[model samples]
Target: MSSRQDEVPTLTQPSEATRRPVIYDVTRIVTRALNAAPNGIDRVDFALARHFLARDNSARGALICTAIGPRLADPDLALETIEGVETLWREDGDAEADDVYRRVVEALGSKGFSGASPTRARKTPNLLYLERNWRAMRRWAPHLGRPLRQAPADAIYFNVTQFLVDRSWYMRWLATRPDVKPVFFVHDLLPIEAPEFFRAREALLHPRRVSNICRYGAGAVVGSQALARRLRQYATEKGRPELPICVARLPVSPSFLSPAEPPEAFGGVNYFVVCGTIEPRKNHLTLLNAWRALARDPAPPKLVIVGKRGWLNDAVVEMLERSVVLRPHVIEAGGLSTPGLRRLLAGARALLMPSFAEGFGLPVAEALAAGTPVVASDIEAFREVGGDAIDYIDPLDGLGWLQAVRDYATPNSPRRRAALERNTGTVAGAEEFFAKIDEFIVRL
Candidate 1:
């Protein structure tokens, strides 16, 4: 690898359409577990890919698949490859089979599969699930052609999700490619800023990822201006003061825009919903404790937690599993469909987001777009996206959160009325978001 430079290249004039084919990196999506639903990053990846495919005739965009580990050089994934994957992703792929496999995996993992003996008998069900998905993908693999031997000199490499950042070898190899210009979309610097919230390995590796972007990327994109400023500071600190940065707001997906009836789970009762993974930085504990305090009310508002369990959140998980007072009021609606989540948000008294930190509060934006009230942390990112439309509070202030929740729960509450009045419509959509990106690419 070349020595780290203090300067990076600036965006040049627009190139001819044929010379500037945008190659989107799909290493993350291609390798995700088949049964898993799309998360924040996943949604961004799919949205960008879908937009490119929709405009294939007008724009020169292609999806390229790259492996993360040792054997990094792989052929470009064909257009049909993305189509097949999108089909499975959108439909959730053989629901019954996925459910069965998920149950088996969950049951085994809960039973200490991590420490289980390396015996074939113990691995049978796990292997069976993998084999089934493998065979299904194999049937579609033939339709997706092999990767290309080389890319064009002026091709642009766009990585929206920052996949494989820890594997510096692969990223460095791509960076050194004289023919392609690499651009990365940095979601956040949380791992570097608040290392305690993430695993030790990630805390160690994330700095390298930022360093790589500063050293080799043609430019960087951020979801909010707050993140853009953070990246600039990091670049200056690393002695790469010339790094180019762009700020583009992420779009609320169309699914979140549509109106729907509340799901039957609510049972005609008013509830507050909190979306996102159960993790330390999310501050689920604060909400849990507040709900515990409110349990004394004969008719306290229900709390709905929508997201799967994430790493480093054993305390929150324990509370969810064992707290008697929380049992009746809290609903763990993990694996909710996009439509289901939209309805839940639409019907909620308010969406409670007491996250200690955030790159971009998608759920908060989604809730506001759905005309649902929001009671969130007074973080910069939330302030950027939500402005004064949300009821902001200090993430650590449990009493403040309880009061906000209570105000929203009361019928004809002034806070709730104000939030509803401020709901003009959906803020932004995929088209507008991608248009900004496309313009940025053109300028590059």
Candidate 2:
């Protein structure tokens, strides 16, 4: 026998072997300032902040976080003090940041920190919001600037989105920094899909931003595969390379998953939940019409909407308020706590979210997890998240929605159970998601 015969080749998966363990390193560039619960992306920013602080010895890994404004406070310093994942407190800056943040802070009181002295106080929060856009407003501090100059370079990872304003600054920053592979989260291509929805300048600028994203971003994370596919389609149509995009399902807070006690006003009445900022995109006007058609009988299930009023539809809002069925049947919850939302969902017959478009429908999944049925539009993003679990309807068809509501309202239905069972396989935990994110980070 040859001496070479004694040596055996070792089989190994390099991608698996070289993959990094779960590590949290955020730049603490929060969306919609420190105070707002602006939109889906803003919500995600807060959720991620909580996740990093929740782990053991997490301070070593938690990069650039502060209890203050959008800037990263002392890196090695602040993480050392974070009490729990959910314990981070934030204070409102002066107005250049969106009104949502100020409203959220005043309405919610620093999320998880209520009655906690260091957090609850209006004057001195554990953190303060720095007015970055404040040029003439130097009375606030010496170190204030439009944007922080030096960012801590070495971190496990960073997250960002392609912004329309100050596009050139970020574009230059991203193109130069190959080491800091910003995980750009793709929300939607609404500007590409529905240009009429935006103003002339916005419509032109957004597609350009999307094109730049396809060209420059190192790694891309999308909320749903449908969105990923849509982005890829945009890239292909624009003659750009289809970069490898990761799909991370958004998670509902633990508060919403458990059996919840309903509010006293519910008084054992069945209802359907429709959540999102009321606007043309959300198709609330159409939903109100659908509910009207369904309520021809003495009393139909109430339609509970949980969001604040948003742009582009005054006539629709006026119509909803004046409807015969809507005055009492429509419960405009107007942004409740995660627990409050869960309690509402727990008793709901189903979640009705017949949106015209969505990057991913979050409330639909939340409803499914709560064992409540979903009635959403047949949009690709919803299908990606809810699978065949939801009762799909046309946003344009109020009559179809009426039928869907009737079907879902029926108890002990085999169709509903089947849909629920099918979606269970697609649901993923945070650790699983972190593992996937780690793989992408190591590749960079």
Candidate 3:
């Protein structure tokens, strides 16, 4: 048992002097994303919090946005807290978490089922939902504000992504607290990668946040080495000393790896799967084209796209609505249950993810664990996770993706078998990563 624990990679547990650490999760981004529905980042944040809570009884306190109306619901409030440490819901803060959620829901809901089958309810307009829910949220927001004042003194705040976008005077003040050590999770520099999608006013705010992260943060946590390198470069450009950064790969719950019997009905059709929000950086348009090209061949496998629609791409959404070829071959099942996702991964011939940017391709790891082969873009993050296991393709090459998709469909190759074997047990357990976190907290 002792030897097995050592085999897992985690930081040393803190000494007797250190008790359980209180951590604040500052997540304006998560709140906004959740408002958008099919909230992937929010889901990740929830999973991370769940893991931390389950692993250590001593770990306490969490601060999050409550999307409830300015007045509060007891169930939502109670659901957000830790046993000993404080948990704060700051929906009343500048960003107005619930306000955004309502807006996003309405926006998607308003689109009404465009070209969707009567039996298939997939996507909707979310922005309009917010407008309808706004007045109620205004009432709810005030109740959420009162809790932040009472958070535990020894808490170490964990900020996910850039909350600095909201320009909350309160958040900046909270950052300088003497007892709390602020830790920020750097997911990706998407604004840097694809600036056109973001509003100019918003895009300019990150450099200042990066500077603050370097100057004041106890440490910055990145999901991959690729992001760490990008952060270091950002540090160098700003002339700030590079601070300590840790790479914690994305984690899926143990349930995802559980045994599952294949479905009784796959209907004799092979399919490729792509999961993630349908956004510009995800390069879904290129994927659609590749799938279209593949459809020209006889007996082409279906393309299963699982995700909610995301910003600044009306054309792709329209294509999804109008494309004749996409209808029979495309399976658009937006956001699935974890078990459903696991089953899909287990049965899939390959996970086709041509994402141009990622901090750590979590799905790629999940696919490998499910014994599914992957054909991913030859980007740094994928390389970090997939190593030589993935059939790498350039995002620019449609022919390459089509060929790779074909190659992946006809499996039984030695390379595919070896990749799945190599990926097993390669990722560190959640406990180990959290222990490293505990050690980091003690030193601070």
Model 3 clash number:
29
Candidate 1: which pairs clash? 75-147, 76-147
User: Highest TM-score: which candidate?
Assistant: 1
Q: Which of candidates 1 and 3 is the stronger one according to TM-score?
A: 1
Which rank order by TM-score, best down to worst? Answer: 1, 3, 2
Q: Rate the local accuracy (lDDT) of all candidates.
A: 0.68, 0.55, 0.58
lDDT leader: 1
Residue by residue across 1-444, what tens digits does model 2's lDDT show?
Answer: 121211122324434413332223344332233322335655565555445444444322333322332233333332333222122222122221323223322322222212312111121222322343122123223322222224435333344444442255435544444554445667788867887665567678877777776677555667776676677777767665446576667876454455655544445565677888877788888777877676675546666677766777686677655555454456554434454466567667778887888877777767777767787899888887777777788888888887776666666656556656665534556665555554555554
TM-score of 2: 0.71
What's the count of clashing pairs in each model shown?
2, 4, 29
Instruction: Mark the regions of model 3 whose C-alpha exceeds 4 Å error after superposition.
Output: 1-20, 26-40, 51-59, 64-140, 144-154, 164-168, 197-202, 411-425
Instruction: TM-score each candidate.
Output: 0.81, 0.71, 0.75
Residue 416 lDDT in candidate 3 = 56
Task: Write one digit per residue (lDDT tens) for candidate 3, span 127-241.
Answer: 5444434433444355454355455566666666555524445355565466667777777776766667555754677655776777667667777767877887776676654
